[model samples]
Each structure stands twice: as C-alpha cells, then as structure tokens.
Target: MADIEDEDEFDDLLELLMTNWRNVRQRKMPTSSGADNTAMVASTASTRKNGGAKDDRQLAEDAKVEFDMSSGDSENLPDEDEMEKKVPIPGGVDIDLNEQAAPTIRLNPKAKKVGAPRKSKTVTQAGDKSDRKWYQQAEQGRQQAGEVTLRALADALAREMPSLVDTQCRLSGVIVKFSSAESKKPKLRMLKNPVVTMDPFYLLPPKLLDACMKVLSVANTSECAIEVDGSQETRTVAKKDQVETVVIKDVGNYSRKQIENFVRIQNLKTVVQLGLELHKWLTIEGIPALPAKYHDVANQVAAQVLETYPYTQIDCLPALPDFTFSMLYRAIPPTWLSDASIRALCVRLTHDFPSCRFAGFQDAVPHKTRTRRSSAAPVSREIQDRVFQQVAEEGVECVLLPLNFHNTHWCCLVVVVSTQRIFYYDPLNQAVHLKAANAIAQHLKISGLQAYDVAAQNNPIQFDAFSCGIYVCWMFIRHVVRGPPLDMSANALPRRRFELFFYLLSGRLLTREEAEQHEAEAAEEDEKMPAPPAASNADEEEDVPLTQVAK
Candidate 1:
C-alpha cells in the first residue's frame, strides 16, 4: 500500500507536469519588461554559478523527452520503472502503511483551511485570477527562455573559441545568433529580438571577451552546415540556402501602369510647379521672391508628385506649342499669368472658332509705338499692319486682343469691325485703358475698316489679386460663346484652374459636364486612397524587409 501510494502521488505530479508543458506550448512568450530583465539577470547568474555542464546535461534530458513526445516515439521515452528510479519521492517522506498504525502527519497551522468553505469565488473573479495567472506564467517563461538562449550562445561561442564558425540557435521562432561575417556584408539579415545586450559582456573577463571578438573577426566566410534548434524540431541549415522575397513596385493609389487619368491630373500641378522652379534656377542664381510662407507648400507638393505620379518622365503628356513649363505654371491660380500662355490659348481658340481673329501680345501693341513728326506719317501704321495682317487674310468679322496694363493687370479688347463697335473687358471691373482702345480703333481704320465706336459693357469683377489673367482668359470665351454670366466665385477658381490646365495640355476645352464628372471621380478616388508620407525623391528606392516584401 505504501509503494502504491507513492506511485500514485508521482503519477499526479507527472500529469501536472505534462499539463503545464501543453499550456506553455500553446501560448507565445511575452515581451520582456523591467521585471523580466531583473529575472533574466538573476537566472543567468544562477546558471553560470551552476556551470555550463550541468545546464547542458539538464537540457539534453529535457530535449530527449520533448523530442520523443513530439515525434510520437514513445518507445524512446523512459519507462515507468526507470522514471521511478530517477525521480525523487514527493515531499521527501516515506510511509509505513503495512504496520497497521498510520503515523500522524502534522499540518502547518498557517496553511490549514480554517475558514467556512473558503468562500466560493464568482465566475468573474475566477476569470480575472485565471487571466492574471496566464500573464504571470507567460512572463516567467519569457525570462527563462531568454536566460537559456544567452547561456547557449555563451557556451557555443566558448566551445568554438579561437575558431568560431557560423553558429545559429532559434527558440520559439526567435533567431538568437548571427555570424559576424554575415553581419558585415550589405545583406538584409533577420533582426534578433529580446537582444542580449553588452551587459552580458561585462560578466565575462576582459581578456576572454577580447579573444572572442578577435576570433569572430578572423572567422571564415565560407559556407558551412549549421544546426538550428526550433520549437518543434532541430534541422540543419546551410548558409547558401536562402528564402526569396518579391516586391511589387506601384505608382499612386492604383497598381503599376493602371493609373487613372484623373490621378495623373491631380499630380500635374506639382510637376508644372517643379519644372517652373527648375527653369527659374537655371536663369537666376538664387530663389525667387515668392513668400517663404509657401515653402512648406512647395515641399509638400513635390512630395505628393514623387510618391503618387505613375510616370518617370513628364514628356509623356501632350506638349503645347510655344508653351514652356514656366508658362504652364502661370496658368494655375495664385501665380502671375504669362503672355506666352495667353497666346497659346488664343491660338487654340482660333482653331476651334474660325470666324474670329486673335491678336498676339505684339500684334496689338500695348505700349505706345514710335511715330514720325508728320500727321500722314502713319501714326501707328506698323501696329496696324501686324494686327490686320491675319484678319484680312482670314476675312474674320471679330478681333480680340488680351492687353497687359503696365505689366500688372490683364484686360481684353474686342472689335466688331463690321458693326463698327468696340467693347473693353476689364477683370477688375475698372474702366478700360482709353489709350489701348483708341490704339486698336486707329489700327482698324488704318487697315481700311470703318472707325469703331466704344460700347459700354459690364465685365466680371475680380475677387483675388493674382487671378486677373485667369479671369481675362475666361472673359474672352464667355464673350465669344455669349454664355451665361461668368462664375468668378471662390469655389469656381480651383475648377477653372484645373480646366484651363487640361485645355492647355489637351488642346481642347473640357465642357462643364465633363469637368464636373472627372472632379467627382477624382474625389471618390481621393477618399479611397491611404495618405502617403512625404517622399523627397521618388526615384530613391527603399530597402524593404524580407517579410513585407514577400507580402
């Protein structure tokens, strides 16, 4: 009976041990904390005092049992008889049940259950305790794992002292070792977690640590077979064998080569801005006088262009004749308009509406021309010749010329040669330049047309300071089409800017319906896209990790 009782108690302990092992295997080790570091240090010190040989022996025994259980090789596991011989008796007590008188076992008063049924715990209370226990056990297991890994590394390094070859050890999918040779090369290697810091190095003698580093430096870089002990199995890993990672390069929110036209339009503003900046830099030695407040705006614009633009070259888009990037930049809002861009728009307008004749910046002279000291000496014959040269050839009924007043404001002048009427359009709603209107009238008369009369007409009022050129460009279209009153509201500015830019690029104006439709599509796509970080140079490639690159 005594022998049977002892065997039963041992079986219960064995059952508890097996149950603990299963729980440990199912859960992952927790991250190390301050308490974990203290626990790890204490464990490492205790391990070192006990010597490496003892730990190795214990590890070997544990590994043998664990391997047998994992591989379902029960035959290799110790039998009950062998286990009974090896394991000590529980509580260090021996019983004599055969003597017919059982010895009285003294129980500690402090440990006795003297309360009323130990007060049954509620379900929530029990669950809370279970969760706390789980966390505590996980923390303890992590410290133990870290301690064991450091011990293993030290022992391996010591054993291979003066001739350290490639060594690797993994615990629960954690890589705890890396070769010095592998680390020196420019290869993307796996990073070790719960890293053993230089604190452990101080534990070793100075001479020994120095010798270890020297040995590692002189270590051979040749490929060698190494054993890696994982949670489930121990396998041989070679240096030459590598797991490949694939990275897919994409542009904007969409995939490569599938970028939408609206997405490209969204980035065109920045491309034009940068190209203008580059051109300015080429001409001037220093930056332009645009306020420093726009510095961040320019930087952010460049970043968006780099991160989301799908093409490598800007030349992919249709080019405008006599329209440089600087001129394109001026077509956008808040930037001063350029005469070249206005001329380009006029050319396109003439192509679409052949009944009208348009004048270049030079054709209708905004500045006073040189005149001889005689009445019949052609007061502005040179200007008259240039302005009507095209109109006479085309036999057009109407002529429009965009005039720049003192190089600060943009206004338009229209002449109905057949009706003998002239209309002046000013973006600011201010009175038109009388001198400019009279100059065009004289040119028309010199070209053998009837003298024109000035007609009073109200034009759109300019709200912003720098958008006069945009308003002037729009006024020409409205007057030609005789469309509804122009929308010069704040909300319409951005829409007009985008439309004007699109027109300049495509050589055809987008109707109101088409522009609004594209804007809606762009808005939807914008909401779907995740915000990308500011990338200074999109051409610069990033070194993505193997795990993410694979995904």
Candidate 2:
C-alpha cells in the first residue's frame, strides 16, 4: 500500500509541474509564427527550468517552423519573469516596469490659426495705349501762336523808332489816329499836353528804324506789350454841317526874342552851324584872328551840336579837336593892350552879329577886360627855370604853366607831348576840365589826367587847383560837324556838375595837402554845435526816466 501511494504522488507532482510550465511557456512564446527564433529558444529553455519533461516533438516542430519577427512584434511581447517580478505586493502596492511610455497624439488640426493669403503672379498689359493726341496738339498750337504774335510785334516796331531798335532808349508815349488822304495806319504820338503829332513816315531814320525793329522782335519774343491812353481829345469832323471852320484871329506868334531863346534852348546844332559859318567868314576876311584858337572854338560848337542830337554819328567828327580856344575864351587873359580898347573891340564884334554870338560869351564878356589883373602874381621866369631844372632832375616829361586872368579866375594849357595828349584846366570851372579830360581820354584811348606837381624835385608836373575847366571842343567838331537836330535840356548841365564833383572828391585831381585841408574844413562844419532842443515828445511824462522805458 505504501509503494502504490508513492507512485501516485509522483505522477500528481509531475502533472502540476507540467501545468505551470505550460502557462509560462505560453506567456513567453511569440503570438505569431513570425516571432524571433531567439525568443522561442529562450521560452523552451525557461520551460525546462520549471522541471517539465522536454517535448522533443514540440521542439522539433518549433525549429521546423522558422519565425520572422519584426521590431513591432518584439516590442508588443512582455517577458514572463519581468511580469512576475512586477506583481502587486501583499500591501496592494502597484508595480511598474517603467513609467508607461506616453503615446504620441497629433493635435495640429484642432488648434486655431491665422495667416496671410499667398500672392498670385500678376500679368502685365502690352504697353501704354492711352490717347495723348489732344494734349500734343494743344501744346503745338500754343507754341505756334506765341511765334506769330512775336513776329507781328517785331514788324510793327521796325516801322517806328528805328534808332531805338539797336540803341537803348526809354520809350514813353501813346498811339493815336491821324488822317492822311492816302492810307490808314496807326500813328504813335508823344504824350505832351499839346499832343505833339509826329509824321509816321519821318518818325525815325531808316537805320534807326531797322535797329528798333530787331530789338522789338527780340523784346516781343521775351515780353508782353503794355498799352496806354492819352489825356487829350481827338478832333473829328462827322458831317458837312460840322465842317472844319477856322476863325482868323490875331493871336500873337512867338516874338523875335522868344524865338531866339527857344532856338538857343532847343537847337544846339543850329547854333553850332551858325557859329561855324561866322567863324569861317571871320577866317577868310583875314581879321588877324587866331586860327588855332578858332579851330578850338569850332570844335566846342560841334560838341554842343552833339549834345543836342546823341542818336547819330553823322556830322560828328571821328577824332577830338583841340580845346585851346574854349580855354582862352573862358580865361579871357589880359592882352598887352588897354582894357578900354579890348572892351570896345569886343562890343563891336558882338554887335555886328548879335544873333551869331555864343550864348556863353554873351553872358561873360561884358564884365571882362584886357587889363584885368590876376589874383596870383605872375610866376617869374627865374621860378620857371628853377621849376624846369627840378623837373629835369625828377625825370619829368613836361611842365604845366598856369596863367591867371582876372583876380578870381585861372587857366592852364598843358603842352606835354610825352603822353601824346593835351589837357586844359580852368580854375574857375571844374566841370569844364573834367569833361575835357574825359573827352581826351576817350579819344586817345589813354588814362585820364591827374593833378600833378611840376615844382617838386621828386614828382614834377603835379599841381593843385581850386577848380579846373577843360575844353572838349575838338572832339565834338571831329565827330559831328554836320548832324541831326540837337536836344537842349538842363540834364547835361547837372550831369557835368556831378561828374566834376565826383572826380575831385575821389582825389584823382588833387594834391594830398589840398584834399586834407578840404576834408578838415568839412569835418569842422559837421562838428558844429547842435541847435536848441525841440519840445519834448507828446507821449513822454516829465517824471519818467528815458532809460526805464521799454525799447
């Protein structure tokens, strides 16, 4: 009975071991036949450790069936022993092999998002086909109109003031209508109170008109025209009943004296012509006259003529004439003869041709005489020799000899050929000298004269004078012996005075000592005491201090 019980117990033990082994083996085995061969071998070995009899048939079958497990199959299988090691303890504590590997979840589509639209490629048109036809036509038309207007203005100006075309002249006037039985054309008139009517045909010389036309063309192209109206009324005859009737009335015309004065004031060329004629007759009669001096007089007459008509070079001489005659006339030096005799001779000569007498001489000769004494004593010959010696030592070219006429007046006739020019000086009238200098300077194309001292050993031929008057008669004669009408206005006189003052003040014609003295006197006068104070300002208070006020 004991033997039989042992046998049974052994069988039961074998069965229990087999059952545990099978469970472990099933857990270890891969779920698919494609499991890794290494894992299958490990399962078989583990099953043997559980004390189960090795099943050769199962081993052989597993070997025969080749398993090909991928990485995913291997990751899905769990180790039986590792699972057993992680089993929950008796205290109910959970076991983990490692923190569970977090599964990756994609949530991109669930999130809110904002974005710009993608740009599409743009297509360009062929070219600019917009119409510019009207714009181009308008621009061309404007240019054409401007050109036409400019041409017409130029044509009109060419018909008027011809000289004004080429030369600079200030034009001031208005347009008016005048009757010519022949044709109709707008006539330009002077804006004077009497409405001076000018002949359109003879308004300007042909040369002047042509020049004016060219200028007008250029000006018209550059500028616009300004039209003006006259204050005077035009006389018109509308019907036969309103025929132009004239009543014969004794309205005294200009008297002989008035006419003479008018002519003298307005016609410088006429005066010059008359003087020239009279001089010529005087020369032919062999009146023991000074021809050289007369020539000088003729030149002055010509200059006066030029002053009248500055538009044309006709009748004006090309070269300057000598001014010696004008200088002598103005100086009126005392002749060796008696004063009474000289005065008598002057009266007779003037009386013989009163109309031909010079306007200047008419005013000046009456009080002058041959025996008039000079204010400054005559320079002695010895002094002159000493001056010459000194001039020679200083390398001077020439000497200026000043001749005093009346006690108040003096003159100088410089005969220095070193500069190939002559200079005249009248101490009584500085304008005459400056004009003469300017005329000579222009003619000779040489530097103008300066005040020189003829006595100084270092600088000879330089002298100081209270005043000087130079004659430019020769230049006038050379330029225009026969010319157009002259203009007589007081404008030249004032200009001459101004020029003389400017030259003198500039120290161009004065010695250092003379300039200094004149300046000192002027300063002294400027420094004089002020006049009595005027009444206080109306806005000022008596007690208020001027310094306290806001500026």
Candidate 3:
C-alpha cells in the first residue's frame, strides 16, 4: 500500500515535468505564496537527485544560495510586496523566482512571422525552355503544330521509349538467388510512364523530336521500311527479327522522294496497291493500326500507312492519310475527278448558292501562319474544328465533309445542321460506313449540330472494286447541282470538267447539246495544255502512297 502511494506521487511528478517542458517557451512566472514557492523549489531539486543522502530542503537552499550569488538578475528576486499578493498553483506547485544557473532567453512572445523561405535554386530554374517568351514568338523556317505547344514534341518523344527485345536489368544493388522470384527477369517489356520533369537529360529537345517526327512520319506514310530507336536509352536497335512497331534507326534525317500530287501517276499506283491490303486488314484487325467499331478508323488507316511506309512522323494522319484518301479516291485507273481536279463539278455548277467550299491548308489553323504541324492530327481538331463554321453562319444548307476513313477510303457526309439533317454518300453502301457515319453524327454535337435526320443515297453503284469513294464524291456534286426530284440516269460519269466549270460560271446547267459542245472545247483545252512531266507507263501506274497527294 505504501509503495503504491509512492508510485502515484512519482507519476504526478513526471506529469509536472511534462507540463513544464510543454510550456517552456511560454514562460510566465505566476504569483504564489513564499512558503509554496520554497516547497516547490525543494521538490524540483530533490527530483534531480537519484538516491542522494542529503534532504531536498537542504539541497534547494544550497542551489538558491549559489544562484543568488552567481546570477546578475539576483536583485530582481520576488520582493516582500510580491510575496504578500502571490498565488500558488492549485496542484501545490510553484516556479522559483530565484535566479537559475542558466540565463533564460528573453523571447518576444508577440512577434509576427516575417515571410516563408524562398524556393530552392533547383526549383526556381525548372521551367521548360518553351515557356520562355522568345521561343513562342519564333516564327521562322520551322512551322509549329497548329495547337501543340513548343514542348509538346519533346514531351511525346520523352513518353515514347523503344520496346526491348531482351531483358537487361538497369537497376543496381539487388540480391539474386537461384530459387528466388527475383532470379527471373521480365519477359514482357513494360514501358514506364514518363515522369514530367525539367531535368535536361530527361528528354531530347523539341526541335530534335520535331525533326525526327517529320522523317518517321514520311517513312511510315510512304510505306517505306526504315529502322527507328524508340528506346531513348540505346543508340541502335539490332533488327535480326522484331515486332513491327519499334524498329531502331540512326538519329538523323533520312532521304526519300517526297510525293506532292496524285496526278503524279506513279505515286498513286503504289499507294493503291498498298491500300488494297486494307480490306484484308479490316477482316483480321491487328497490326500497326487496330480499327475500332466507329469514327476511329482514321487513326487505324494512318497507322497502316505508317507500317507500310516505315518512315512516317508519329501523327501522320493530318498530312499523310487524308491526302492519300483524297488522291486514291480521285486517281483510280480510267476514273479521275472530272478533268483531274480536286474541286467538285457541283461547285462549278452553283456557288451563288453555297456549294462545296474547299477549306485552305491554313483554314484549320486560321488567325495564324507559318505552322509546323503533324499530318496525323486528332480528327476532332483537324476535321470537325474546320467544318461548317464559315458555311453554317452564312446559313448554307449543304456541307461536304470528305471524311478520310482508315486513311484508305474517302466518304462524303452532307450535313444540313440547321435542319438537323445529314445525308451520307457511300456508293459501296457498306454497313460499316453507316455505323461510322452515326458515330460522326454524335461527335458533331460539339459543333451545335446534331444529325438526328439521316439518309443514304441509292444510285451510282460502287461495284466490287475501289470506285466507291469516287462515286460518293460525284453523288454529292450531282445532288446539290441537280437532284431531289429523281430522274435515274443510266450513266452520269462526265468525261471532262472544263465544260462543267464554264456551265457553272454561267449560273445554269448545260443542256445535252451544250454539254457535248463543252466537252469538245474542254478536250481542245487539254490538248493545248502542256502534258505532265514525261514519265514511263510503269511510274504512272505504280502503287503510290499519300506523300504525293498531301503536299
């Protein structure tokens, strides 16, 4: 019972010490009676001694006497006046007013904080170089991607690492046991998510990435095979045999013929031969591109182009696929866009009424010039962004969207947004086209246009071959210029566009006699016009890619 009581007192003493430690900085010497103050002073001294022989009262007195003589503030000890009014702590404890061995620091309890410490030197310098004003203002030889910031290319490159063929551990200081799980290395290469940091060595500069992209984009776009080193860590990728997506190439520009126009007959032939493989690909969907159920076919086509070309910029769709589809649809053997033109026959037929208005190369990136953009851009950004803004506001009913699907086929969707009506023209009448068109209508909701009303054109049999796209384009032209009240003509393919252009300028459709005379005049003009640069027959019919058409 006596031991328990002693333990309780010791616990109380420990609690007192904890309280003193907590309130050390708040140091306030409270008013207390002299007797109580003296008793607390004795207890504090006694607590410090461990099994000492001398009584606490004697030790306390000695400590007080020594401090009173040593301390400079000894004169400020509690006076008689303070003793008479002083109050003791309710728990029978009091702080000693007598000077201590160590002088207490006089802190200003009410001082306000000045400010937080400045960020470290490393942190302050971490901003990207493109964030600088000068880089953004630079409008010189290089063109910026319409919306990508200066650092975007660099960021993409940093994110893209080459897939490894064999396992080689890069991390150090790991124990390995023959029977342990750690003994085996990873079989499948897992790409680490790139950390976004300002470390200089973390990524190649944007200029370098931009240069690389342009070359790679062209290679894949043209169906020309080339090596690429996607794994930034290594300089060369040994290509004995590897999966198609990540081939290692030297870090420099490669030289290949750049194709500018589909009229360049050789390029078209080569591209068509490669494009014919797309039908096979769709049935067995896998490779450089994997087509989805709907609108994503554009990307799949772009990828297929890259895989075939082996030298395309990463996002080659904007420049490569769209151009390829446009050219492919127009350049099939024995079929050309009415005298080799991209302009619609209907546009020539009527323009006072808003007909097919071609958007310029810079129309998509309007209010800016000198752009260095990727060819395979997002469909929403490249196609929809530029759709119908000019025509819609002008209240023109018909809109022509030359949708380059899978970068292999071109399908026309005529939108009457105000009327919430959409008419799709695909001469092949493929169910896939219908599904894709519906997906497109949903996406059109962003433009404040909902294609609730949908219909498909019935005429112009596309046949089994690749003439469907061509037929689709003609249907739009025919529908806008002369249609709705149906008269199913047996044959509608006009041999010459020169007559059509003149007839359109006249603001009226040509009669059967007038059309024949116009055809004669158009043929004479063709004979007078200089022939395309002399090339062999083989070159004119060579399987060409989109590189020629995009330019």
Candidate 4:
C-alpha cells in the first residue's frame, strides 16, 4: 500500500508539472487575435484623426481574422479563474506577449496640449530650419526678380534711344498705357497722341544726351528743354561777329575828337612868361650876354619884341624881323649839335647871359644834317665875358641883348644893342664896339659862318638853345616866383604837374603827402562829428517838433 501510494503521488506531481508547463506556454503565445483587433481599432482611430475615409476602415476589417469558440465542443480544458485574471495595462498596446515591454511608450503626454502639434511631429528641427531658409531664399529671389524687371526696362529704354542713355523720362500730366501687343516693349510719351510727335531718333546726339543726363542728375529735376532750334550754332556765329567788331561807333568817334581838341588849345602867356623867366635866369646866374654883332637881334627876338619895330637900324642899314633867316645861322648836324652844340652853347651863354647856364638836352638828339654847308656861325668867349661883366657892374638883375643885321647892296653889317644897358648907350658917345669874325668863330667852335636852310635842316644848335632856354626859364620861374613850372610842350602835362597846377589854381597849395595826411585827419573829424538831422519838405507835414526830434 505504501509503494502504491508513493507511485500515485509521483503521478500526481507529474500531472501538476504538465499543467504548469501548459499555462506558461499559453501565456507566451498570442491570445484570441483580439490584441490585433485592438491594434486595428487604434489604427482606425489614428486614420480618422488624420481625415482618412471609411474605405480604409473597411480595408482594416477585411484584413482582420475571424475565429469562433464553443464551450461544449472544446478540445482543451479552460484555465483556473486565478490564472485567467487580467494584468495591469501598459502605456502602449501590446503587439507580442513574448516581446519585452516597450519603455512606457509614453503616448506623447504633452501631445495636443496648448502649444503641441495636432498632427504627428515626425519632422526634425534641422528640417524645419532648412524649410525656413528655403522660404527666405524664395522671398529674396522674388525681390531680386522685381529689381531685374526694373533694370531690364531701363536697359531697354537705353538701347532703343541712345539719347536717353543716362537720363530718365518721367511721366508728366498723366500715366499713359503702353500696350505690349502694339510695340513689343515700353516707350516714353511726353505728350498725348497729336498731329506732331517728336521722334527721339532725330532729337539729340548720343554724346550730348549723355551730357544732358549727367546735368539732370546733378540738378535732380527736369526744368530745362532740349533746345532743338539750332540756337547754339547761331550763338556761336554771333559771338564770332562780336569778337571781330570790338570797337563801338561812339567810342571810336569820341576818341578821335578828344585827340583833336587837345591839340587845338595853346597857352600864349606861358610862352612869354617862359622867355622873361629865361632872361631873369641869365641875369642872376652870371651867364654872359650875346656877342656884340648878334646881340641886338638875339635880344630882340628872344625878348619877343621883334614885332614892336618894323625896321631897326643896324650899321646904317634897315633890318627886318626874320625868323627864317636867323635859324639859318644856327644850323648844325644832329649828332654834332647834341655833343658840340650843348658844350658850345653852355660856354657861350656862360659869358653871354649873366646868370643862366645851358642845361643838357632832355629829348632825343638828332644825328642827321640837312644843310650842304658844314660851317656855322660862332660867338666869341671874350666878348661874352665882357658883356656879362658889364651887365653885372650895371646892377641889373636881368638883361636882354639884341643884335641886328643889315644886308645892303654893298655888304652885310651887324649892330649890337643891350636892352638892359640901352640906358647906358649915350647918343653923344655915338661909337659901337663890334665882335670880330675870327673871335666869333673861335667861341662857336666852327670854321666859318654860312647860311642854312632852316626848313630843310634839323638845326641842333637852335634846338639846343630853345630847350636850354626853356629849362633855364623853368628853373628861374620855380626859384624866383616860388611857384610851379609851366609846361609848354604840346603833349598833355604829367599827372604830378597837373595836380600841382590845379592846387596852385585852387589857391590851396599842398604837397601830395600833405594832402593824404590832411584827408585822413578830415575823415577822422567827419567821423567824430554828429550826423545832421534829416530835412523835411513843407508839403510833407512833420509829426514832431525840432526839439523833440531826437526823442
């Protein structure tokens, strides 16, 4: 009995082990395919949320497997109640019971929350960044396209009309419709369709248009027109004519009249004063008088007294006033006269005129002779000295001596008369001293005395004597009269001389330096003085009294 019991226990133990093995295997296998059905339901829910159709649901149902289980026809026995108990649910649906549980699939706890996406957010952050970059690139491309369109329009205008190369045409008044069907491109319309339309082709040159555009860009506005009247060419021609005819009619005529009027006016008193002044110089400076033979004529002519007497007696013959004849005796070559005449005149006059001496020639000295005769008249040095000494002894401040010549049928004889010493010549004495020809020749530094054609010859001796006499006269006038020197030249006087003359004429003598200083002082005084009150007309009534004017 014990052996049988032990065997039965072993059998029982084997049965329990088999039951446990069956249970374990069942748990490892799929259950009733219901889990797949649950998976279909979950898939259907996902599809419905994603806007899928019922056809997809039907397809899911068609893919499902159907199985039936009867309680009476069962081949296997059911499990105990404790073994059939359900397990705790997980976060995700179970696909394989044998497989390890997925780490709490989580079901995206934050899904469909406030900021979460309603759909599956399977795209990566890098993909989203890429998408944004692409969108920005597209926007940039659109902007670039707009710029390219404008640039193309501008380029088309530039190519069609070269005159509009750098210039922009703005639509004034109204915008015009440019039909692409009509002309394949855009065009500028400065005016409406009318009888006359300016063709851009013939309007302006390409180079000029470029220049115009540059000017317009600087000015920032179109305020000027493209002058097509050929005015530029006309202006150029007009300018050429203006340059050629520079002198105006009135200006030319006035200049000529001014020159003529200047030459016509002469001062006679200045000439007489000049001669008297020369006589005074000769007397004060100890220059000798003229030679005895020619003394009377020299004095008479130079004193301007030749017109006083018609016929003057010289050595028992009658002598007439002859300027032409007198000039002949003084002829000398231009060059010889400049050097020799100055020296001879100064030497002779130093004796002839008691006070005057010959100053050097100021104007250009001539060098050409006009006479055939080389010999010239001379004056003696001894005679001139004796004459000067006599005048000095007479206590005469100044003396003019005259020399006269009488050409008779027999011979030519001369007489000397001193105007200053005319009172000294007594009619009772009745005796006249004469200068020898040799002495005269020696004093004059010439070989012989000969006649000269005054009209033909540039007589330097006479010219020198005239200039020296003028200079001496000017010096004497300046020194004795203490006044300005007179100008006898035909040309206009120097500015300084004119100013001096005007000052003397005005009876207000002031040097230029003094005048400037006085002007400055006067200006200062004017500034210091109070301004004068404004004068009112009687017709214009005054609103205030004179005492209340300042207030």
Winning candidate number (lDDT): 1
TM-score of model number 2 = 0.16
RMSD of candidates 1 onward, in order: 34.7, 38.7, 27.6, 41.9
Residues 269-295, model 2: lDDT tens digits:
222333344334333432232225334
For model 3 the local lDDT of residue 245 reads 26
- Is candidate 1 or 3 superior in TM-score? 1
On lDDT, the stronger of 2 and 4 is 2
> What global local distance difference test value does model 3 have?
0.41
Candidate 1 contains a number of clashing pairs equal to 0
lDDT of 3 by residue, 397-423 (tens): 566665555544556667654566766
Query: Where does candidate 2 stray beyond 4 Å?
Result: 1-269, 280-396, 399-410, 413-551
Return whichever of 3 and 4 wins on TM-score.
3
lDDT by candidate, in order shown: 0.49, 0.31, 0.41, 0.30
Give the per-residue Cα lDDT of candidate 1 at 26. 41
Q: Report how far off residue 275 is in candidate 3 (Å).
A: 22
Quick one: ranking by lDDT, best first? 1, 3, 2, 4
Candidate 4 lDDT = 0.30
Per-candidate clash tally: 0, 37, 50, 22
Question: If scored against the real structure, what TM-score would every candidate get?
Answer: 0.34, 0.16, 0.29, 0.14
